[model samples]
Target chain A: MAEVRVAVPPTARKGEVIEIKTLVSHPMDNGFLLDYGGRMIPRWIINRFEVEYNGEMVFSADWHVSISTNPYLIFYTVATETGQLDFKWYDDNGEIYTHTAEITVT
Target chain B: MTQKSTRRDVLKLAGAATAATVAPTIATAQSAGGVVVIGAGFGGATAARYLRRAGVSVTLVEQNSSFSTCPFSNTVLGGINNFSSITHGFGGLRREGVNVVRGRVNAVDPDAKSITLDGGDTIAYDRLIMSPGIDFKWDAIEGYDEAAAELMPHAWKAGSQTNILRRQLEAMPDGGVVAIAPPGNPFRCPPGPYERASLIAHYLKTEKPRSKVLILDAKDSFSKQGLFQAGWAELYGDLIEWVPFSEGGNVARVDPATNTIFTDFDEHKVDVANIIPPQRSNRLVDTAGLADGGDWCPINQTTFESTIHANIHVLGDASIAGRMPKSGFSANSQAKVCAAAVAALLAGNDPASPSFINTCYSLVAPDYGISVAAIYRIIEDGTIAPVAGAGGVSPSDAPASTRALEADYARGWYASITADMFG
Candidate 1:
């Protein structure tokens, strides 16, 4: 599993539609306690995520246990203004992980 | 007799003048009846002062003779301030003509409008204000109670326990672990445990680099998450370990004998343990038949009058102030609104629409601070909601100078709150 990285278009004209990419570092281990050598290993996984811009929802997705470790997601949205882009990831256990990046449109 | 006044007539005039001088004093004492206020901390002290300013006599009943604040207690842990700096005398309140009574209230009778002191004396009041703050739910954490606090200090209420925790931190050997067990939701000062971790980590980085501060949080995320994470990353990234509730951080029990905290799956033995237990309204509120459920007294949002009883107002941590975090600032704000309503009722005037403001500041390091502020107004539905676009967390990517200014603002906020409440 690699670390999560999120990137948006480095430069975009004002009001231009651009792509935003996000990748997270996690092993989406589903809760299936499997015994290896008579030892139980509890499962853990990232379940869902959403993207918002300036307090408005832009894109979202739901994931399952089978979505491989450190899932990367990408989406497109029109840059309307200079504001914040927020990303939130939730694990199967309802643990929420959030990150935000700034976008300035010239 | 007209030309030369008789001595008897002159004496009669003197007697009338003396009676006139004494009449207003007796009348004021009768009309300006004193309110018996329990708890002389932030909320009670503020209410007493404001009531006195409104020409209402006040008798402040406090268990302690002096006041010691929990606000900025993290500074004491960080060695920035001592207990003396936070300690204040009640002389200022006394100078305002408030009768400062030092005794524990045994019982409160709403019907009788009186409070029974532990010394077998009863004080009657036209109105009673109770702000006894929080009492720990000792049973929530097994093997932990008032007796255990001497060794395993919670330090949540601040004073001696705070000093004890600071001393323990100083006494720990290098590379030792300082475990801080934060309670669940509905605790006083939601951001408090995190701030304590930051300040302790600050102390360790300079004095004992090899030492570590472990935060065993019962919740997932806390106030000002981004700012705290940024400070941790910049200052002591690896030295501080925060284990959330999903992990093995949820503490269920503690054995004070061995200085060990027991979670569901593991036992953590630490050099020092600051266990902030689950909290509820003080015992008086519960015993007075005021608490509705969840160990807090429910009240009407507008007047802060108890939902169970009429003409009895409950403010501060004892009241279930909806949508407001249990903080000193929130308590102080609510007390002012409550005071206004009480005064309006006394004057036979309708209470005005009430509003409140709260801004909580947390110092992540000596030079780094963060805050969350909100302005709240009572809606037509009688519930308080944050005024939109009024307040929020500090921007995440703010510059170093902004962070430094935030530190100064944090100090200023403390001074302002204390002044508003006590000064």
Candidate 2:
């Protein structure tokens, strides 16, 4: 398990664009590196990230080995309803880490 | 503002004033015809190039035909880099109209504004920039003189010493103990000893897993301590042990004949010994009377002019720069600022307010890296101070991907900075 940090405004005017920023800690170890014993360290990384607003998919990204460790993402979406934004990070090892941020729009 | 903007402003002013000084120039400004920079290391070379870029005639004197940078030399020790890869020539600087003179400067007559070469030639200068770097205090550690350095190598200066240490490591048998004795504070590259230890541990772990590294440090804490220790534990686990000064880590004596280091409470006989003794400004500064009875040269933060002497500037590891570590990055930054100030002085203009920046990256493993960075400016008291919240070390809990990125960035930095220097 890794620590994740995200920033989002608590409230926004309806139809106004809002910004969301996120950071997560992960090794994202690409398989190319050699260990002390001259063996290749296996690749383990977060390969996909997606965001949902009010149960609707608003943004999604496919991450690769080239993505930096501790992946950080910043994106914008229009405030449509008073609800929550669900953030999910999919790892290469079939594990999904998720977080939720609630937002009020009037 | 940032040092980048400051440098741009200085360069802009220098460019605007170039035509005015072009005809008379630095050559006609003084009887001797231009600026003379001693040493061709990071500080002197950058200063000479920048001055020449501003159309000032500059002569750079160096004892060596080529220079090997101290930065990235540790990678050589870790067997990941070749010595020749770090060595650089002066052709780029020479091509830029810098008068690259290869010879030993025997003496500097500050009053006459002239320096004497070993072969009896005297080069006069409108101003002198001395960046002689550091020289060890041979008397600081017993039995660790120049002769003993051949055996118990310091490898602090790079070049041949670096090769010696690497060769010693390669020749040592499995399970051999390598003892590293680092000096106290205010030395060149504060994080260097620890980085060396980490790289050596990397080499041992790869080829000789039975071998271990013992760091007998003179300080209780070191640069990027938490990050380095965490990386060590995660990568080389139990292979690298650091002994702080409080716990009999301060080396009192070195008996190289028996390959042993003696402290107040204990003695260790190791397979390989690296004794980095305390250091001061290179002997050239002492000979030129620039140190003013001190180990380092004090300078004006804004102009880098020697406090004790007029028309003489010092930079690099030899200078007492406030809040700046004596790293190559600091030297290069100081050199640019000092060059601008010197150019402004020659043009009878007050130098642009100077700022500096330094970023040092150390590799704990081939794929793991950590760094510290800072931006600095002169405060009201005429001393350099780091901008609040402007810079800091890499986050301790950064993911391995972040470390890998830093490692790649470290390699990129080496290529870019070296090109910046040599070009």
Candidate 3:
């Protein structure tokens, strides 16, 4: 589980390619380290990161253990209308962390 | 930035005050030497106020526009205290006649007795005080860096990180496991992590119901452990699980890419992880050459003068204080002691023998609280030794009324200490 923060222009002109940024708090434990007893640390990283705008897939990435904790992602998307930008992070634990940011377009 | 007063104005005010009271050690009949204090946290602010009252020309420099206290920040995570309640401004110190400068002091030139600001401004002083507090030893914890902190928030600094951790806890679903990895000894607030678990469990018990708190401690035991255990048993039951160092509680490493915590024997994949790294004196000590080959500065127990630097004092978390636990109360007490010593030293007299007191109260639940208090003395050998049997913690399973009373006391202590530092 993580707290999600997103940055998007509050208002945009139609067809503008606006930059969208997102951040989430997580450990992204890659299962490489040892536990207190010298056992291997089981990995549980966010394996998939995706973003959608107005029912269209705007951005996506297949992440690995290299993706640090509190994953941050940024991409460009055309402002076609006033709609919500949806974000979902899929982890090896089968947990889905979701967030949404609304954009207003004139 | 607040307007700076001329040295003459300070001397004039000091002269007027001295005429009414017994003259303190004075570099002049009108005023004492100028003292420059760095990092206006509890220690610096308290020293500034007391020095100004003692008629010493003083300037307090701080990098932050406002201070966010770590003492009661856990309450913000529990929704028991508002974020603004723990944040303070420097307007109070300025009004009290302390020249409060807002800037990042970049260097301390010991021989010259001066400090340099980032923009090339230099401040000269006869005596200087630094209480820059602690910094994270990022290398000690593998894969945990400043950027990774955004992913695995420590919330140790009590600002943006605290907010981030709180939001993570709030966003966690029912039946989720919230994990905490508390750093080893010599860190700030000896009993903080447990208090956080207690309050977080209280919040979860009410809201999430099925959630649990897993505490992985670096030590085998902790301050007030018995009382905390008793309270958890009586209130939270199985909602809290503790793993001590003896049983693989020590965190060997953390991976942010997976939100995983690794111990020597086992690995935990948690829903939310709070990783607090080992600490050292703030990096400012390195630039000042004050930390004599250690992570913390060594100070004269009697006067808090840094052993490596003459005419300079270090107080609070950045210095080694034998038996004192790093808490807001401890810092406030040290600052007052340091202020008095600085005044006496400037006035051409040795400082009076120092005695200090610290009381830390923790809330286990909104209505349940416990406390620990200690009295310290600078013995003949100059070690800050706690008076034998002079301090104790609240009794386990105290009556509900007593717990509630202690909760009230916790609130009162917060108000009183903030007043002492910033009022």
Candidate 4:
């Protein structure tokens, strides 16, 4: 299980661009490193990240091994009739870390 | 990506200007019994804090509000630490009653006993302590200047350059050649380039196994050579190769346009190049005449006061302290001695004799660490000399557990030392 954090403004004016930021806690072990015992630590990383605004896909990113640990993403989207924003991160081991935030748009 | 471009642009500007000119601002006043310390890195910050603790009014002026240390910066390159983890602010010093000003010092007037900031504000001081650190000898390497630095980053200053090199490494393809050209002896952090080589090798091992690290050196020997080589062989095998000066390892010039390094005998077209050119004390030392027609400031060993100037002291990498390697730990130790001397002079008291200690820890891998430490004191010749039998390097034959323990201690050392300086 991974921990996720999301930042979406609680209120925004209609037709105004709003910014969203998120940070996900993951080691993102790229499978190339060795452990204390000198054995390989298999590749583990968040492969995809997606954002949903009011049940519609707004933005997404296809992440790779180069992404460092505790991945952070920030993007902008126009605020119209904001309600709930859902963030999802899909990892290599089939784990999906999710977070949701509520926003009000005038 | 924005962060990368911004950092690159900043380095480009720094390279373009001999003395970077910041926006002018109104100068502040310094009261009597005040001490102004330039540079807020390990040396200046420690001296300012200690001066404040000694009941002396202090002002610390620095161009950057935050400091990123060279120590453990290798961890950032190795992917073991984040840039933010090593970055620190001056909030702790403010709480200690030290006036922390954010600006670059443009001039030092020893006669007036005052220093001018970039914007033309001059602050008077009873005593001035400088720890401005190192500036590269750009002319030493043909075709290697600030613009070329944009392509082949030095990453020696530990903030933006550090990131640029790491990004280049990340963007490099597997099996690509990464070249690191270390300067001759007496540069900052004698073991720094080698530590960088080790950690960069660590990164490529896990992320790009086919890639290799190539070190083209200007010096035939380096600090902790035996220990670093032993660890390199044990962990990285032949992934890292070192070329000494005798073997034409000295980089004569670089062609950044082609990503190539030309030595006396061989020209290597590397995928990524880190050229750490020769270094001297910050240009301010030369401008202020504290270097006394030499590359480094000559200071009185007992007080760290410049022998050429009255009431002005030099500390850290800028000053020529006998037998002391240029290191963050050395600077921190020197700052204390200088601080005590400054405080005594301000109080009209003879300064007490001082002894210095330095312990430099270099991480070879995430779990493997090695160190060289020494205790120094003023000898009869008025120069600093290491106290024999007081310190030694890590044993070459240490076990895995011992190496791991030293690794843990290295992290602990970074945490505590930064705290002592910043606070």
Kindly report the TM-score of the first chain in candidate 2. 0.94
lDDT string, candidate 4, A17-50, tens digits: 9877676668889889999999999999999998
TM-score of 3: 0.76
Write down the C-alpha DockQ for each prediction: 0.02, 0.01, 0.01, 0.01
Clashes of each: 0, 0, 27, 2
Shift in Å, residue B222, candidate 2: 0.5
True contacts kept of each: 0.00, 0.00, 0.00, 0.00
Which pairs clash in model 1?
Answer: none
Worst 10 residues of 1 chain B by lDDT: B21-30
Deviation from native of the Cα of residue B365 in model 1, angstroms: 1.0
Q: Candidate 4's C-alpha lDDT?
A: 0.89
Q: Lowest-lDDT window of 10 residues in candidate 3 chain B?
A: B24-33
Q: Which stretches of candidate 4 lie over 4 Å from their true place?
A: A1-106, B1-31
Best by DockQ: 1
Candidate 2 structure, TM-score to reference: 0.76
Residues B1-423, candidate 2: write the lDDT tens digits. 344567778888878776666645565445446799999988998898888877788999999999998989999999999999999999999898899999999888889889999989999988999999999999998888999999999999988999999999999999999998889998999988888889999999999999999999877789999999999999999999898765557787889899999764468999999999999999888766788898999998888899988998999999999989999999999999998888778877889998899999999998998999999999878899999988999999899999999999999988888877778
Interface RMSD of each: 11.9, 18.3, 14.4, 20.4
TM-score of chain B, candidates 1 onward in order: 0.91, 0.94, 0.93, 0.92
Candidate 4: TM-score, chain B only: 0.92
In order, what is each prediction's RMSD in angstroms? Answer: 16.8, 20.3, 15.3, 23.6
